[model samples]
Target: MNKISRKGFLKIAAAAAMSGVTAGALAACNAASSSTAASSGAAGSYTPGTYTGTAEGISSTVKVTMTFSDSAVTDVVVDTSGETASYGAAAAEELKNQLLNAGSDEIDGVSGSTITSDAVKKAAKSCFAQAKGEATVTSVQLPTGDETDWLGEEPDIDEAAITETVDTDIVIVGAGNGGMFAAAYAAAKGLNFRVIEQNGNVQDTRHWVGAVDGFGAQEQGIKMDRAKLLSEVSRYASGKCDQRVVKTWINESAEMIEFVRSIMEDKYGVKMIYTYGDEAKWPAENAEHNTDYMYPEIEYTYDRSSGAARNELLLQYIQELGYDVDFKTSLAKLEKNSDGRITGIIAQSTEDDHFIRYNANKGVLLACGGFPGNPYMMEQLDPLGTSVTTACSYSPSDKGYGIRAAMWAGANLDKEAAPMLFDRGVVAPGVDGGYVDSDTAFGGKAFPGTIRQYNPGTQPFLKVNRNGERFANESSPYNDIVYAAAHQPGRVYAQICDANILEDAKRFHTIGCSAQTRNAGEAYVQGKMDEAIAAGALFKCDTLEELADKLGFTGEAKDTFLATVDRYNELYDKQNDEDFGKPAYRLSAIRTAPFYGCWLGASLLTTEQGIAINEKGQALDNDNKPMPGLYITGDMSGSFFANNYPCLMAGVAMGRTLTFAMKAVKQMAGLE
Candidate 1:
């Protein structure tokens, strides 16, 4: 008998343990099987019995169960072994289904687990080959390609590869809500069109997002007053957003909503509901209060009624369109004829490493988002700003791929406009302080459930710097809080709130308590919290004096910090924010016992800079002229918002840009 090495034995033992089979039991079974196989091999015309073959470099084991009646390949069961939970299990199940139905080695790869699928295929092939006395094991390589494969690459113009080119009425990049709308509109007009997406799926972010609102006049039973939406967005934009863009969004908002509704109901067979709930009131009071500064008549919230269902439906609609929609492809380079006419796009597949030429018979629309995920881009855009990102709450793919593509194409850069950083409150549990999801702190005033609520608003808390002195209003906007934290020395400190406020927070928002408290929230509710703790947010002591000692505050500064808290509390109790003019509802004193402080780190939501585009959604060069054949939209295009974030009815800007791109396509194809 061959001796099994310790490493091999341990691996087998681990596999047996995971399968809920004792190591001794597995060893006995293996010994019996080996003896039976050896006896069978000794007989003439004897087929090899079932063998568990473990492949190298794959996370899973392949169980090859073979049954032979008269030794003529009667049945085969290829059960993938050693699969991880969730994704791996799903992949294994899919493999099993494929094997059962096909009874062949051919199998479709599972989405999001391509490597695992390949591993299974290889293992199954090896088992079958060994049974048939043929070579089955083979090496496989990981898939790769340029940006067009997964990051939405552009076309290669250096070579004349597109020989049989046909003009498309419109070429839209990205398959998000914006790109989808553009394609649908073009199709409705009986125009030739194609959409290019770097993602492997459509409506990628939308499918994962929890809720969305602020579409212009609701259509398909989604009813929002246009005038009200415009006012609300204008106020949120703080007089910095382009009025034309805002107006265009309002005018077409209802149409976009209606379009989405139609796609959900008619095509996808999914019902679309208002998100703010049935009462027509904003879902949360915070949304209402914030909107008061903009449009008082506009309800602050509406229930989409369902998130998961809506996404599934919307994706189905896009798939049904039958338009030339390419996925897992990226834009490599833009093509322009010497005449300066924007012509075609060069795309590459990340899986196959093949370049596909997509001739934009009309024009190419860019609907990529901002560059908040790019650290280098952030520094260039906001030299004075601290490095904080909010994309962690959203899509991991929201990297500045689009922006970089545009820049490489000589597109103009918008220096002033960028996404603002917002605070994500609540750090990882057991840590003194950490980063929190801005939404937890600012997501409608309702305490973001237990998993996120780290700080109470009414707490008599002082945001002290390393010097242990109070800075900025505790009641300031969430973004402001993040900014202060980022600018502070070491970019961290404790937020000293009194015990009474903590108790109230615990009572009202169960999740806001520390880990030490029962029913406490998760260590890190948001993706960025882990990152923030690495940056800073510490918690310390019960009394102001103790906290001061720990934080290294001494003498007059400590006294000043206490005095400031007292003065702020006096104003808070009186419901008079004379110092900061904070609203009465937000004013509250922190004069309670057993004070506690949680450290908070600042993180940003949007990028502060992006590619420059005009009101027409045309990408412009540094010379302020449109880059022929190129258009940009979403966060990728810049100069839309100034100092503050824009509130253009949710998905309005994207909808308008897509619509405009469709129109441009029509004009290019001489169909207009």
Candidate 2:
């Protein structure tokens, strides 16, 4: 690429500005993008029924359903195919609201997200023709700048109101694993730092992380093979994880582990338990709450403790080290100096909504969770994955404020978003206290169910789609039913298990299958699953054919399902699965009188995909260069994993969060 002269650059920028392109991410937009802005027509000019239309989004086609009565837009719903949950989801609702408020489709799109907003408008226009009406369509104003706000517009902040400013060497946002580690290490390094968290207490947050991979476990009698670990990580990440970042994590994890071990075991007297095999794997901490799989090294937990204990202990030590920390302090936004360094951060106190400006002389480290709590973002980011906003595993602090703020400040994001979709949860209704019945669990445009619900029928069973055919391996290597089920037809599937399996799940606590909760996996089994049957969540039948009918399987699909089960049983008897190659010991035939079954919707743990960041934890710009003073860590730096988060290196993200934050601090403090 040739560099343009200053005059040429200014002319081109002027041209873009003249075209109504505001402060938004200006990228290679689809030339064919459309919008439905009407100039001279009234909104109440169409027929009064539901109509469907489609528009292309950045990643996929968006299906929009527009409803009109008396020619006024009454309702607008959307299925944004592959649009990001972080941006498009909110765009859908906001666009709908705009249409309703304006009583027409002529409204301008939201700032920072002109493209997605235009798509919504275009789809609304598609419905106009069906109602015997026409709309004056328009095109989106494509941005020319690399940086844009959430609405895809360039941001212009006014810093006239300083209010308050506290000078600090380091400003850390969110007391998550990354933020906590940054605080500890910065204190240890004698850097003037303060940690700010949106959540008040450690326990109130979603800190239930699992596993921390590293070596030097002689005392715990666990040996780690670094080479094999790296290979496994590469395989699990499917070659998407940056090799530089992976190498750094693998090389430094042992030291991080030693830090944790010294504080956890030797100093704090926290018990470190090491277990072998995948017999009972839930958290890497060996605290089996049912659902088990093979992660021999991962199931290392503190003595009868969990992720919360680990953080609380770290917090204790940080406080003991006399570090300044503030809970319930949210990272509102970042302000950059002319040198492109993050000079200050605007934070809002969650308790009373008081604002404070933290003037950082050195740097600002951002690791404030992901966009799970934002309902629209959960859908837009991982459309193939279900998102019951009520069920995301975090507190109310997971709105992606930090990530979006960084983007607004010129940080780049990974459009190839990879949410952490796992197969460990239950589907409940979106409404308050409304449990999503098993039958209608997977029928939504997005992934269903509350995330990380308590051991919702964890033991892996033979899973089949609505077509009653097997898709992926039921178990092994984290083949999450959440992602699979979301893509399945009707987004619904059944977990078929025999009465014996359900009974065993209840009677004994086994791998990934917990009957501890009274109505859990094994507890709900009976000759007839009356409650779930009434709730349309479960079905029971004496014969396989009858079970199929009760669940609406017919013809070829029914036959294929029966054959799949028969062949599965055959493989079970032979003690070998030649098809998907599921381990024989873990395989169980779906055979038993009066078969027991329940509908399954996958769970959203924590999304690992976030903004793109370089090895030094600096958030990258559109050119893939580090945005000085604007650094990202934890899930906020999303380029680490792609496609899926593998179980191979369980708890590695948590470790990376700490290690990476410390690394960024070191770089800023000139200690590296």
Candidate 3:
């Protein structure tokens, strides 16, 4: 095995690389050494049967099955379906070959997938133990159903042990969208603020920001009804959200849009355009939108060399204004005064593991994001949301550290979870959606057993569960079908469309980010579908029956699938859906020559539930009282969302994040 040198390990550990490896890495190394010692000379002799061993991977459990002969290992299979498709999953074949060649679990890790590679070696060691007929196997403990608290007790940091101390007007806990906005406005007001980010740079940015009646909307002659918008958002939250926060976004989002335009366009020379401008594409024949949903002209985009450059501009802008962000600094905890008022925070430097105290005279703003990246937090707070997901695209830095710190300081978190789920997780043949055995890394976990995306699922196509029965009104919002499928057998469903997909998708006219595939023309759509088919993420067949069989439908399932297709055709011909009340224009038939099918689960974007805050962006106590020097923004600030994301509003989450970030800065500066 290629073991890292002591110097190399120390260097990486100091840099905080490879998932916060310090004490954990030392423990893991010791465990591996002990396991190897226990199974020292048992490589040649083995029991001649197929043995399976499992370990937690980046997202899901990685299972290694080996068939052994009397003298040599014959066959080896490594299942990394739960990992990132291009990274860990793609490295499975190489890892398997390495294990077989070495005749043991001691093998070099794969490039770009160190976590999954380590997991594979760990699990392979277990298989070696089982082959030797050992009394006890060496394996990491998987989650048991008897677990109580994922969030344990808070840390006790001694003030005397602190290495350094600094005083500032404000302390920002992240450099993401919310943190950047807060920092920009803080610099504009000439506040001596200290911004710290755990990440090396700015996190990935979402493409568009939602607003209402901004300059873009004004130029496009679009005006939205504020009351109706508020009502629609409130309805999406099941009336559990605080309307005061919703109304704050609704009324101030336009101003936020204008302010961002001034900085991004006028100051930074970036051109911003309305997403639903005059050149926007919509179905020509059916021009009206569904009344049950709203597509307000509120989103705007900026031209950039890369997908994230527009957001990164904020950091550059802040730097130019004589403020710098301290990268590789993570929040330790929020400190409070004797009167029970938040005063400042203790932060740990990831570089050398030294603690530094930063006293904030004004307030501390936490924009470190929500807990989508933390499996323990997700499994605890958003069990159902995580249960139905099969993939995650959220930032790894979003581990709910900010929320937890506030909670330790007597902040209340929203009881309900509002996960931003999209219907795009593409799974292979036999994989299903639900929680899986996740890794013990601090980086984060992905939803297991899926690839990047299956964009075709975004269209209002004919969907059938594993039992091959239509289970939902396919014309509903993005996440509705995924949520409905949670009750199905495998917590999954298949989206079946035919050769007329090009024309049908055009007619479907899906709004928001889902429209990218359709707008890219037939060539792009077919290319993506062909790629998915090659990757085994999709199934293509000439007939509906063949497609059903290929998609794992058997016996009654195959019969029900064919029947469901026929019934859907009948609904298409009648131009009405009595079964699910789907709009006739969105109804697609599956009778074309070449048919396509793909099993889908939800792709989690982020969690919107966090420390509860008021309209002023002040972190609230259990009694709904504001904490004196604690503010929250981005996903770290909750009480504004519940259930699922309101996708119909375009980029409302991003809008609310930026809006509240600025609001928090103003309130902390006594301007609000």
Candidate 4:
């Protein structure tokens, strides 16, 4: 066998037509034998051989490879590359060491990575079983079908196999921002509701919670043009979105914020702060009308971590109210009556795979998240999104199950896909942007590369395609760059800058989430850049030519890159952008030494389109009539957004989720 680089293995594994027990699996083993004895008395003897096993992880499959000898465990490798970066992926090394040191799968799990740790142990056990010749091969292959078939046939669950049943006034699917808020309001209204989530705890991935004309903005003396905001959102969606649903958020968002403040602050003693885009500003030359797209103060906790802190308190408050969020419970299917009214749902216990029936007397709210983590849905609904996206912040829980369940129950889905994209997914040289045909535990295409977050990529830098030609105005909305790059060569672009990046970013004054690094000061920003440089995610060189070569610009592409730089410098010197109509203040010449380059596509935060709904948060049928006793919220609900998520408002997505969650609960309780 020929020796292959790790990067080569990753690239090959992604595109390979993998069957049961793939060759990549054997190659990934690359095992080493050891005679080291077990440290604990429980360490049992094993046959001398290399073995591999796999199990389901937080987002994808976790594979374990082990080499064993009589009375000892030798070398071990845990492949957690598919897991969440901050949690499961980070726990890989520790889990590997634990397996080797203990000589058994019974080892302590890493903190905050329980799911991955459990998967590692399970896979390790299977490896040990294989080493012992116990005939236990535990790897399961994902389902595959025609490329265009994302909504496969509905599951034919056996009714007699259900182990138990429960009754409730309201049944809420998911314990994310939408479901949690719905539960909080339900508890307050004295409604007996059950909230079910597949994950072990609540999901809080974002911080900002946008609202229009909320008390926080009022206290700060900030005002908004309702009509202008409405028109801007309509324009963003190309008028495909339901204006009535958009208007509902515009009208009730203030009330939602106050309700959040009441629970987080008045009840839980967690102080919240509301902020407008004060830290970022457009150039003075750009008229005030250009700033009309900005939002008023949005609510947030004290810091990034505080968002989760407040959520923990909210969970405690719900538990104290004699209600509980059922974790490790996955939705199976929606159960409806013959009258076309949703009656309840069938949920599977993630721990035991046993099915349980939940009967909702009032209504059922589907706040389960979108399909950013589900590759099947991405391939079918948003192939362009799947191609350009490299990373996802969503979890395995967001498998588009809620949306599919609604569709199976006669709900109509949005004809167009709406994905919330950010210009931050950083790739390395030679990696083209496209969907990788890797088979995952969740049936979808995997990202082609190991991408990192290039937050500063949000700055309006001089971006060029593989042919080294300037593509578009980088100062536009985040998703616009991704869409534009889709039409470019290799479906990827390189962001080029110079040593004056710190000062340039400060002057760029990009608003919304882009302003985060700019506000963090030069030191923080430089530190991040340095870290990226150290990680080989960024290319830094003394000359533009060297930078171009490092970024994969060859021959004519290199010359074009040099010419593009010179032309960009000319524009910067003239303080005008004639090609793309970019604001002059945002232009920064790439003349300084020690140039930097990073290949980018887009990072997916979540998908924004799903089952179509009305202003009342009720799912709509094919005839545009509301589906009785069925409500939708969070990313699972659509019609308020159509094409791309409007990130200019910071937390509009979460705000819309919470606002409509309240609407759904109230509507079910007869208060609407």
Ranking by lDDT: 3, 4, 2, 1
Give lDDT tens digits, candidate 4, residues 445-525. 566545446689888899999999998988877888988999988778999999998889888877777776778888777
Give the per-residue lDDT digits (tens) of candidate 2, residues 156-191.
322432345688888888787787777778877788
Q: Which rank order by TM-score, best down to worst?
A: 3, 4, 2, 1
Q: CA lDDT, every prediction?
A: 0.47, 0.58, 0.75, 0.75
Whole-model alpha-carbon lDDT for candidate 3: 0.75
Q: Which stretches of candidate 4 lie over 4 Å from their true place?
A: 1-148, 280-284, 288-292, 295-301, 305-308, 437-441, 449-452
Can you give the lDDT of residue 206 in candidate 3? 73
Tally clashing residue pairs in candidate 2: 41
**Predicted candidate 1: what Cα RMSD to the true structure?**
14.5
- On a 0 to 1 TM-score scale, where does candidate 4 land against the true structure? 0.78
RMSD of 4: 10.2
User: Which TM-score value belongs to model 1?
Assistant: 0.58
Native-to-model Cα distance after best TM-score fit, residue 37 in candidate 4, in Å: 38
Which model, 2 or 4, shows the larger TM-score? 4
**TM per prediction:** 0.58, 0.66, 0.79, 0.78
Residue 497, candidate 2: alpha-carbon lDDT: 69
